[model samples]
Structures are given as structure tokens and as C-alpha cells.
Target: MVEPSVPRLWRAVLPICLICFLYLCSFLLFFCATNSLIYSTVCLLRANESYCAEIDQNKSLIILEESIQKESSQWALYGTLSFAIIACFISPIYGSLSDTKNRKFPIILTICNAILTGLIITIASIYQGTQLCLILYIVANIVNGFGGGTLILISSCFGYATDSCTHKEQHVQMIAIIEASLNIGVIIGYALCTFVFELHTRIWHILLVHVLLLVLALVISLVFLKNRSLSQPSTNNLSQKIIQPIYDIHDLFVGLKQNHLLISFLILLFSLFFYDLFRMGSGSIVYLYLHYMSFDDAHYAAYFSFEQLATCLALILLVLLRRRWKVNDLYLAIMGLCLSLAAPILFAFAQRNKAMIFGAIPSSMFSIYFAVCLRAIIARLVPEKDKGKAFSFVALIQNLDVVMGTIACVEIYQASIDFFPGLVFIFAATTRIIALIFILIQGLCVSRTPELLSIMPTDEIEEPILENQSDDDNNNDDELIHA
Candidate 1:
């Protein structure tokens, strides 16, 4: 490989990295904003008391199961589902297009979408006294779907950079940085939720903050983030060329079907399913239980924060220890699965011990850190050209899991309203275990492909070997045919 002129590489590639940073910033912004609103909204339905009293009162009242279902029934649940599915598909479509198209095009599109989303939310907040507010919310959600294109944009550009890298070890480090952005985003988002909600009781306040951050992120993206090159050599123009109707999705699905790395990708996908299912499902139940057992939000928040802090530290430790950890990608996944599965049991027992942090940290670490490995694995498995499609397809799987898992959690909570509310979390955790078992079976089923972490350099990632064509070939054949 020709020694890459570091300057030219930086110029061509740094903008996408800038955009990726913007995407992370916006994601952290939105996620925190979403947490603030959702937490506030849910809290509104529960113990209508000061933060301190609310915790104590809620545990004994045990009416949250009823409250949530009543709240859902009051709204058209399908409306929420509509918001998610539409938001789900838009990111990849525009992102895949951006792979060949200029950076300006997608950035402009996302900006327009974010502005529209902001305006819609602003209007909804203004008229929130009327039923029309819900109508406005639906519109805002649709607009939000449009803005979701940022995730794909972020993923595709990283794929571009990953493909262009000359060294194999660089891939792991890059993947780690990419995912570190995500993990840190989550940590920051949760903190924002606590801070933002304290300032205003209104959901509108939270939504407005989300919009402003996104708008700012978009502006940064448009002005500074840029890459002028089109398809160069690797990753072929197959994905860049669109002949099929579902060209983007088709590319990902086609790869998963034929690739030897299917087991690895599939395990990560299922683990993500557990990640959302258990994490989202268990959230309130865990908190309320802590409140019941500990008797105050101040105390419980301390406990919750401690749990997250410990888990976040664990993520840092895992990234550090990853060098010495010799386990296959499968082993790391199983370790994560075991941790996630253990969280609920620990949570269930923590009530007796009154140490929420002690129980929750292991699970949180497993779910978050294991996911990082999964993405890193995929980055190693798939060729650089198709990273966008692979990552987005994985996103699709994870999000789809979220919808179903939420449904199951909601169903369990609804059925057990009169019973122990903690049961909802327990049920969700059980569902996750089932998914985990399947993942274990799949991991055990495939043992032939070399461990990705060993085969690929951690600093530079491995690109899939393109066997037939050499650097001498003039005509580009990006597709890899195994015979």
C-alpha cells in the first residue's frame, strides 16, 4: 500500500469525522431531551408529590402499572408505532444515497428536516391545551423521522474512513472511538434529562431544547463537515449503484445471508434486542422499587447514578482490558449476556439489600460494553464499502427489537397492575434471557471463522478480502463472489 499522505487523508476524511462528532452531539442532545420529557411525562402519572415524597409514595401506592396502561389507552398507541417505523427507514435511505452523493445534499436534507421538526414541536407546545396538540405531536414525530437520517449519515461516513485506512489495527481503535461517542452520549443524555427536567415541568421545554441542539448540530454539519470524493476503488459501486427497489436493505440482507460471519452479527443483533428490552422495561420498575425500599428520590437518584457511574466505569475498564482479554467475540458476548441476565436477579434482590448500585452495575456494563464489541465485530467482518448498510441494518434489527420488547413489557405491566409492579421488570428480564439463550446456541453453532479480534488489527480494522480483482484492474468489481 502506498504510504497515505496524512494531510490529504485528513482533508478528505476529517469532515466526516467532524460530522460523526456532530451526530454524536446531537444524539446525546436528543437522547437527553427524550429522557427528560419521557421521565417527566411518566412521573406526571405517578405520585404527584415533591421528588422526595413521590419516591416514598409511589412505592407503596403501586399503581404505576395501571397508570401507564391507562395513559397508553388514552392515546392511540399505533400513532407512537407510526412515529418509530417511519423514523426507522428514513436514515438508511438518505444515508446510503450520501455514500455516492455529495455531503452537502444529506446535510441540507437533515437540516431542513430538523427545522421542520422543531417548528412542529414548538407549535404543539403552544397549543398543548387543546386536543390539536396531539395532532401536532404526530406531525412532529413524522418530522422527527425525517431527521433520523443523521444516524445513517454518521455510520456511512465512518465506513468510508474505515475503508480508506491502510493499517489493519486501526479498525478496532476507530470502532472503539465511534462507539465511545455513543456510550458517552448516553451517559451525557441521562444527565441532561435530570438537569433539563428540573428547570421546567413542561414537556415542551424538553422538546425545545432537543430541537435547538439538533439545529445547532445540523448547522455545524453543513458548514464544516465535508468530503468531496466519490467511490474510489474498494467497496465497489454495487451499493453505490441502485438497480433494485430495496437497494440499501438488499445489500445488508444479501451479506448476512452469504457471509461466514453471520453468527457473530446475529448474536449482536439479539443481544441488542435484550439491551433495549431489559433496559427500557426495567427502568421505572427498578427505580420505583428503590424508592420503595429506600424511601426517597434523593436517595434513589444517588443509587441510580451510582449504578450508571459504576457501569460507565466498567465500560472504560473493558475497553482498557480488551487488550488482555483473549476470549472470542462469542465469549465476550456470552459474558455480556450473563451480566444482563444477572441484572434483574440482582435488582430483585437489591430491595432486600438496599444497594441498587451493587446489583445494577454488572448488567448495565454487560449490555453497553458487549454492544460495543458487537459493532466492532461487524466493522471487522464486513468490508468497508458496505459498513453503512451493515450498521444500519443492525440498527433496524435493534430498533425492531425495541418495539416488540416494549410491547411485551407493556403487556406484562398492564396485566400485573394490581400485583407487584416489580413483576414487570422481572418479566422483561425473562424475555431477555430467552433471547440470550438463542444467541448462545447460535454462537456455539458457528465455530469455524477465526475470532475477529485476533484476525483484525485493533487499531486498524480488516477489510473483507476481495479475491478476484487486484490493484492492477481498471474496471471496478466491488462485489465478492466466493466459488
Candidate 2:
């Protein structure tokens, strides 16, 4: 078969890129709106207008500002927990569906859910300072969570890219490009929030824009993207269809348990878990951290956008290194983990706005390396049929991070806000250290057992045909051949 041209391949993945870009823009806009509204509500409930106005203007009411921060953080934690708890359970189901069904439906469902969330948030912001507003916020998160939220969209996009590619090299490049698109979306989203807020626009206005963009994304997914799946047809029984993905997850666990490369899989999973725990924990509270450092919305957005740009550049560099230099994924992951470990420490010690902003540079350089590389590595480890379930499992771990990381970092930040607001970053740094240890151990294991590299069939190897063999025998032979 002739290989497709580069431009043709890019065209195929453009829809995935656009969808990711739009979803992230909506996600960040929702985040900024939520935080701003939470702060406004806390001030309204806790203090008089004159005092709140003074706090907003003066920026030196240390005690009162800390109080408001703690209160707002508590509310933010609740909102995050509500969404993450639901998404944690729903992610696997959607991931399984993408594997067993098609990728487009999940992508479209997520965008529709985002649009609904934007509308709910807009209404909530209008009713700010009321209990109903708080209730609506929680309800909106629950609704978004039920649709699988950002994690599901990301998982499905990765699964879609994986399905579209025929070779491991192409797979890695596609994953890198998708990861870059995610960062680009984040950068533009934050920048847009800053720009609109600088114009003194209301939170609802920004949310309206978010909803419109999501509607566009929904249209793209529905009309432009093709339904793609590698799994066989599902059973006609409704009950079986409902439970099959869950069963697939269980079977994946069983398969992992019995695999000869179980140690490598566990190490990679743990590394991903700890790294995400650090990332999510730090990210959930980083905005608040910047707030404490006297940074405004524009400042925070610029800082975050710069960091994301650096991350995007790093991903591009990774793709080049893999394609041109033929760098091993494990080595690149180790390098990224090593370089990223210092960022949280720098953030912990940062006292000035510049210090806090620049502290992320070390991390921005290589922090995304492990995440992108590990997913590609894990993809290479499993069979094609298990890719969806495997990525779903990854998404489950990330959602778990959303719950655990938010709780841990928010609690830490709340406790230390008065004395040392940087404590949360220190905790994040510790998690990265743990991730590094896991990756190092995996590298050692791989080096000691070279045959572990051959666990999966590469694209260069054509599937063998079994002459006059039973179906059962052929299936067994296929597994053995791949193994």
C-alpha cells in the first residue's frame, strides 16, 4: 500500500485538532469565569461593599485577602470535585465506546455538554450571591461530568488519531500533534480570557463566546469528522452493549496481570499517575497562587500562555527528535521528568511575580515530554484491539488525579495561604520526584530484559495467514505472533 502524503495526513487530523482547540478554549473560559464569580460571591457574602471594594483596589489587605482566598478555594474545590468524581466514572465508558463504537459521537457529546455548561454558568453568574447560583454551578459540573468532560474528549481524540494511523512512527507524530493542539488551545483560551476581561466585559459575555465556539466545534465533529473504529460490531442485545465496555476494562486488567511485561506496564502507569497528580494538583491552584502574588487576570493569562507555548515548542522538538534523531521514548521521558522536577520547587520559593512566572520555564521546556511519550509508549505495549480501553484507563487515572490532586493541593494551599502559599507547589514537586523514580526503574527493567521490547507486533511485520486452521487456533496463533 502507498503511504499517504504529509498534507493529506494533516488534513485527516485537522478536525481532531480543531475540536481539541475549541474544547480547551471553552474549558479555560469556564474556569476563569468560575474563579472570578466565586471570588465575587465570596466577597459579597463575607464583607460589605466598601470593604470589598477597598480589598480589590488596595491589594494589601493581607488577612482579608487570605480569608477570601480560602473561602473561594473551598468553593472551587467543591466544583472541581463534583466534575471530577462524575468524569472519573464516565470516562471509561466513553473510552470503551470509542473503541467499540465510533469516536465522533463522544467528541460531539462532549462539545454539546460544554455548550450546556457555558449556558448554566452564564445563568449562575447572573444570579451571583444567591444559593441558587451555587447550586447551578454544581449542577452544571455534574452535567458536564456525565458527558465525560475534557478527559473523555482528549481520550477519544487520541483514540481517533491512533485508529487513523497505520505505523508506530505515524502514531507517535499524530499523538504529538494532538498534544500540541491541546496546548495551543489552552494558550489561546487564556489569552482570550485576559483580552476580554481587560475590556471590562462581564463573565457572562466571555461565557457566551465559549458557548458559541463549542457550538462550532459540535458542528465540526458532527459534519466534518468521520466515524472511525477498529472494533467489531457490538451485540444487538441492549444489556450486552451497555456492559461490554466495562467488561472490556476488566479484561484489560486481567490481561495486564498475566502479561510478561507487567512490571513495565505498572511502572509506566505509576509514573503517569504521579506526574498527573502533580500537574493537576498544581494547575487547579496555580491561578490562586498567582493571585496571591499580586498578579491580575492579564498577568496570569500571559504567564500561563507563555508556559503553554514553551510546552508546545517542547512537543514539536520531541517529534523532531523522534523522527530525525531517532531518540528512544524512554530516554526522552526520563529527560523530561528530570527537567520538570525543578519547576515546582522554583514556584515554591518564588516571592515576586516575575519569579513565579519565570519559575515555570524549566518545566515548560520538557514537562510535557513524559506525558506525550508515555502515552505513545503505552500504545506500543498493548494490542490494537485494546488501545481504546488502554487510553480510557489512562483517562481514568487522570480523572482520579483531578479528584485527589485538587483535594490535596487545595487543602494544602488553604492551610498554608497565610504563612506560605507556596506549600502546594512543594507538594507537586514531591509527586514529580516519585514519577521520576518510577520511570528510572522502568528504564532499568527494559535494559535488563531486551526481549521486552518485542512484546507487541510492529507495523513492519505483516499479519500471518493460517492455512486450513480453525478459528480458535488462528486466534491463538495471532496472539502468540503478536506476543
Candidate 3:
């Protein structure tokens, strides 16, 4: 009997890779532009006879720079919180919509939101050093959040990939590829920022680049991506349409309450939650920390690009380990947590550029595996129909984590900026330790009940057949399946 032929891995996920690449490139660029704009605005305000002007020129300049850094850090914190707060409420609805309506729509909506956000920020850059500029920044965050921000786009993309694959292995590989695309996008964005800013380009110029990339992403998404959600009957009632997503979310929680895997699921959820909180907490204050160390834009870009590249390499290693050694996802996740614990500790003590760059090395060994494996584990625990809900809840938790992490880290950084800016990194390290404990508990539970997280039986799982097979080929396939 002939074996079934699955599509090549690259072919199966190429469209998603392109879409994610374009979106993340623009996404990273937008943040870099915003940070530059904020710094420029603060500098402009300082030059306009602020409190620092009363001192000697050299001392006054030093005081003025510190003030600018603090204000910019505060604004960054506020912007992150506002966006997360809005996306938190809206992500679940979009997640349900993807499961019920279609995946393409939510993705398109997110790209449109990104485009609008770029435009608003560009306009604000024109009016820098004014109250109107600040207002426009606030408005951009609100609009971006309302459209579900990056959180929805990522969840929807993952859901689409999940729908395309038929088994656990395929799910893990596809998810890893999609995540790698995101990292590659960030690398390109940071590289571009470094090159452009080195040439002394204006802030708006970078913003324009972001808008152009977003437009390309939008076009590619429309043309190349297929709607993968299973077809359901269209509903015409307006109120029902509005409330259905909420009902889906409610149903999700109720289902979770009833599942035997509830404890395991919660353990994974909290583990993911704390890890994200650690990531966001440290990430939100990285620029401030670098600035405090007197590192410039090029330095920051280089550091970020290195970090992203390391993550990509780690993901590649994870795929190899799963394919070559048949490692359990839970064991790999535990290994990842253990390996990554050194990163924040390294960061906490880093005082020089070399020290900071060294931190990315240990992180490269396994920092990303924890999130990817945990996500795959969660995906496997639920039924196919609940994949979207599972990912959506993850998205919601991530945004909420961002809100809490950013606020807490930012406040700590602000309070300790003068005496010890590395306190925030220590805080991040603590969160990772907590996440590690929860994952250890999960591993223990799985050890006792080995079937709890086991993959479905291969014979019971049907491989998707191609549409162009001949009658004889179909008969052969059927024979192979039944044999």
C-alpha cells in the first residue's frame, strides 16, 4: 500500500510566514519610531528653558538627560498599559470570531489597525513637543488596542496554522515556523532602524517605512492567505452576531471547568502567564536600562537584534531535538525553563555592553522553547473545536500580563533609576523562578498520569488527503488506511 503524502512543511506554512514576517517587521519599527519620537519631544521640551537650565551648562545637560529618560520611560509604560488593557477585553471576542466566522477577517482587521496606528503616530511626530502630540499618541494606542493589536494577530495566525495541521507533530512544527518568522521580522526591523538612524534620517521617515510594510502585509494577507475556519451557517441577527463571541468565551471557561485536565491546564496557563510577565517586565525597561548605561540607538538595535537572533536559533534547536531524539514536550519545556533562568540573572548584574551582550548567549540556548512547547501542549489538551478558544485565552492572559508587568517594572525602574537600574531585571528573574516551579509541578502530575498529555493515536487521526487524487489512488489510500 502507498503511504499518504503530506504537503511539504514550507509549502504548508509559507503564506503565514510571509504575513507574520511583514506584520512583525512593521510592528517592531513602530515601537522604535515611537521611542525616538518620545525622546525627541523630551529633548525639545528641555531645551525650552526647563528647570535644568538654572544650573551650569555641563551639569544642566546631565540633569536634563536624566529627566528626559524618566519622562520617556513613563510614557512608554502608559502606552503599553493602555494598549494591553484594550486588547485584553477585545482579544477573546476576536478569538471566538476566528473560530466561528473565519480566521482571515480578524487578521485583516489587525493589519488595518496597524496601518491606522502608523498614520496616527506619523501625524503626532509632526506636532512633537506639544500637548496635541501626546493626545495623538494616546489615541493611537486606543485605536490599536480596539482592533486587538499584535495579540489578536498572533493568536489568529496560530489558529490558522492549527486548523491547517491534522496531528500533534505537524502542529508543533508549524507553530515553531510561524514563531521564527516573527523573530526574523524583528531582526529585519531592528537592522533597518540601525541603518536608517545611523544615516541621520528623520523619525517620520522610519514611520513611513512602517506604514509601507504594513500596507504590503495587508495586500499579501488578502491575496495569498486562505480562510481556514470550518464553514458554518451565516447568521443575520445583528444582536446575536455581537453577543455570540462573548457566549463562546463563556462556554470556553465552563468547558475548562469540566475537563479532567483542568489542573494541568491551569498549571500550564499560570506557568505561561508568569513567564510572559517576566519577559514583558524586563523587555519594557530594556531601552531605559541601555540608555542609563549611555548606549545609543545603534547599540540598542544591535542588542535587540542579537536577542531575537538567539531566540530563532533556540527554536531551530528545539525542532531538531523533537524530530531527532523524540523528546517529550514537557521535558523540553522544563529544560528550557532551567536553561533560561540564567538570562535575567546575567542581565541583573550586567554593567557593561559586553556583559549585556553575554546575557543573550544563555538565553539563546532555550528561552523560547518554554512558550512554544507550552502552547503546543495546551493545543493538544483541547479538542479541535476548542483550539481557537485555547489560544485566545492565552492571548488574553498575555495582554493582562503585559499590563501588570509593565506597570510594576516601570514603577520599580523609576524609583530605582538613580541608585540601581538593574532592580527590574532582578524582578524579572524572580518571575521566571515562579514559572519554573509551576512547570515542575505540571511535570510531576504528568509523570503520575502519563496519559493526561499523550498525543492522540495515529490510526484514529485521519491525514488530510489532496483534492486531485484519482479514483485508483483514493482506493489505494483507503486500503492503506484500513489495513
Candidate 4:
């Protein structure tokens, strides 16, 4: 059979690619504004006795660090959790909109939200000492939420790309590039913060600049992007076309209510939920922990950056493996189990000596490896039409990484300092074990359901020709972007 040509990343979407690059630059510059300027303020407050007299929590560094440790740091945990609610609303809805309308509205919404987010933060900084940081934080979180909540935007596009592909292996490669872009964004953001913004040194100004970068990115993206119609509208009735996405979201709950496949993925969800919570919440501790034990903060962040870089590099290895292994549900479950093990095991050993623990502990870099794998697995499980809803369901909880990490990881650190040091590992480990057990059980049950058995590949199952469309395609959405 003649094969359909799948567009390569660098070649297919030059305009969108430029938008992504400018967006990355803007995101990293904002990081420079917010974090890099403030590193020493952190080091000083934490290591007060080393230089100045007893440091005050209200001092520049102390307050910033505490802000991160607390649930209410404005952008860290509490506020993010609240704004994430807004994201939960926007992600899937925008995704459906993109599929129906070719992603223009949501992409436009993103540009507007990003601009508003910056303007709001800049305003808040003007009133920092007054009774206004709280309000600004909330608005900023919501704005950023709206701006960053476009994961489903890309997911929908990739789903379209996947649907267009003839070879299954091509789909996996495309998804890897998307996932890799996220890691690259993180690295650039941190590097910009460390070298440029100096956020740790200056409290308010840099943060405002970070806000401006969001606006800047929006402007850049708007200038560069060119939209293509994704899906054709159905003639049955405009009403059904308009409401198809809403029905898609409803089908998700219904799917969970009716099917066991969603439940199997949920087993993996718990691990993602808790692991993110602990890791993000306790991120600052890596430097602090190392410094307290007489290590260098610059070197520490560098080490972390390197670890993440390594993980990104690891994606290349998966490209080779994906083609060999069938990208199926059972394998996804197996990979999930493997990732769940990394965290608790790392946390369990983080209590050991500094050098050894740093080598073994499950840092953000290590977690990204798991994230990319899980994402690919999830993509393979569902059909293209439902991919937006399915991925949004994952995004609902996935983006809460910082909040959950703050709660599970940070709160644990604060309480455990003198009381129960190993509790972090215990909590992390136990959570994974429970999730793993659920997955094993779910996996066995999935073996029996003929609906699932027929859809997914099994030891005894034979590979079937790729269906023209999954059930969602039968819905034949008119208003979608094109997933």
C-alpha cells in the first residue's frame, strides 16, 4: 500500500514553530525576571548566620523562600490550585473549540489572557506593600492559567496529526517532540531566571517583568501564527455541531462510569498526582538541603539542569524502543508502575548522605522521563476524536504539579524538619504502592472485558487494521479544531 506522508516537526509548521520559539523566549525571560534576581535573598535568609546576624523571615530572601514553602505563596500552591479550577474549565472546552473551529478562538484567548496576566501582575507590584499582593496573585494565577492551559490546544493538533499518520511509529515520534519541547521550556526558563532576572535579589520588579513576558509572548505569537481549518462542519444541524464538544466532555464522565479502561489509567493518575505534589513543593529544598550540608546553590541548580537535560536526551532512546514495542495499554500500565517506583524509592533514600542522595533522589529531571513515557502511552490508548477530552482529563490533574508538590512535598518538609524526617519518602512510597496494586488488579480485569480486549492488543490478540475513526469521529463534530 502507498503510504501517506507525515510532516516532520521542523518542516510542517514553520509559522507555529516560530510562535513556539518566541513563546519559549518570553517564558524564559519572565523566569529571569521572577527567580534569578532572588536566589541570594534565599541563600542569605536560609544561611543567615554565615554572613549577617540572625535573619528575619520578613527579610527579602526569607520571605520569598517562605512564600514557596507555604500553601498560599500566591503562585506556588494554594493560588495555583484555585486557578487550576479555571484551567480545568478551559482546557477541554478550548480543546473542543479548537477541533471544531481550527484552534483560532482558544489561541486568541490565550493571547488575550497572557497579556492580561502580565498587566495584572505589574499592577499588583505597584501595590506590593499595600493590601494588594493577594488580589494580584489570584488574577495573575488565573491569567497564567488561561495562558498556559493550552496543552489541550496542542494535544488536539497532535491528535489530528496522529489521525493523519499511516504508521503507528510515526505517531509516537511526533508525540515525543511535543513532550520534549516542554522540558526544553523548563530548562530555558530556569536558565533565564538564574542568569538574568535575579528574582531572588530583587523581590517585586523582576516578578512584574515576568508578567510582561507573558504579554510579549502573546504579541509575538499573534504576529506569526497562521491558522488552517481543522474539521469540516456537519450539515445534520448547527445545534448538534455546536454542542458536540459539550457532549464529548459528558462522554468522559460517562466513559468513566461505563468503561474500565479509564479506571486503569486512573490507577496511574494517583501516582502522578502525589509525585507532582511532593516534587514541586519541595524543589527549593534541593538547593537548601545541599547548601545546609555545605554544598553550592549555583552548582546545585546546575546539577538539576543537567539531570533534566539528560532526561530530555533519553527521549531519543525511546524513539528506538517505541517502534519495537507495541504502543498498547498494557505496556503503558507497566511503564506507569515503573515510574511510580522511582519517586518513593528516591525519597526513601534522600535521607542518606548528601552526595549519595543527590545521585539517587528523584528530582524534577528524573520525573520528566516518566511524564513523557506516560503521555505517549495515554495517547495510544484512546482514539483521535476523544484524544482532546482524554488528554484534558489528564491535564485536569497533571498541571497541578506545583500545587500538589507544594502540599505533599513542601508541607511534609516543614513538618518533618525535626519531627518525622523520612515521612516524605514514606508518604510517597506508600502512595505509589497503592496505585501500583490498583493498576495490577485493573490490568487483570481489563484482560476479561471483550470491549477492551478487542480494542487493545494482548498476548493472544492480533493486530487489526487501524479504524478510520474511533467512536468520537462517528459523532462527526462540526465546531471542532480538528483533533
The candidate maximizing TM-score is 2
Candidate 1: residue 352 Cα off by (Å) = 9.9
| Position 373, candidate 3: lDDT | 86
Ranking by lDDT: 2, 3, 1, 4
lDDT: which is higher, 2 or 4? Answer: 2
Candidate 1 lDDT over residue span 1-483, tens digit each? 433334444554555555555454445444343332333344444434364234334555445534643354224234345455675666566556555554345555765676677667666665543556556666776666665544445555556556545544444445545555544545555455556545555556656666666666667666765554354533545644444226756666577668655666666666666656655333334443454454343344344445555665765665555545533555665677677776776665454466554656656666655566666666767665566667666655554654465466555655654555457657756766776776666566554455433443334322221222234232223334331
lDDT of each residue in 1-483, candidate 3, tens digit only? 433334533454787789899999998888777877776676677676354223222443655566776787788887887788999888877887788877788899999999999999999988977767777888898888988887789888888777766455556667788899999999999988888878877778999999999999899889977776665855648878777767887776677667667778889999999989957645547876776666667778877888788889888887777665667788888889888877777776776555764665766458788888888888888777777778888998999888998888878888877777778888887888899999999878876864674642222322322322245457767899999
lDDT per residue for candidate 4 within 1-483, as digits (tens), equals 323232333334443433444455445444333332233333333355344222222344444444333322223444556556567666666666655555445656765665576566556555543335555656677767765444544554455445444434355556656556655655655565455323344435545555555565566546654453456754547677556767877876576557556665665566456545454445444434443333343445554455556667756555545445555544554564555465455545555355555565343233444555555556655655566666666666656655555556556655664444556666666655664565566567667766556444434322122322333333445436566
What is residue 464's positional error in candidate 2, in angstroms? 26
Where model 1 places Cα greater than 4 Å from the true spot, the runs are 1-65, 72-79, 102-112, 127-130, 149-161, 199-203, 228-245, 251-271, 279-308, 324-327, 348-354, 449-483
lDDT of candidates 1 onward, in order? 0.54, 0.79, 0.77, 0.51
Q: Note the residue pairs that clash in candidate 1.
A: 168-460, 169-457, 169-459, 169-460, 170-459, 170-460, 171-459, 171-460, 171-461
lDDT (Cα, 0-100) at 61 in candidate 3: 61
User: TM-scores, in order shown?
Assistant: 0.72, 0.90, 0.90, 0.70
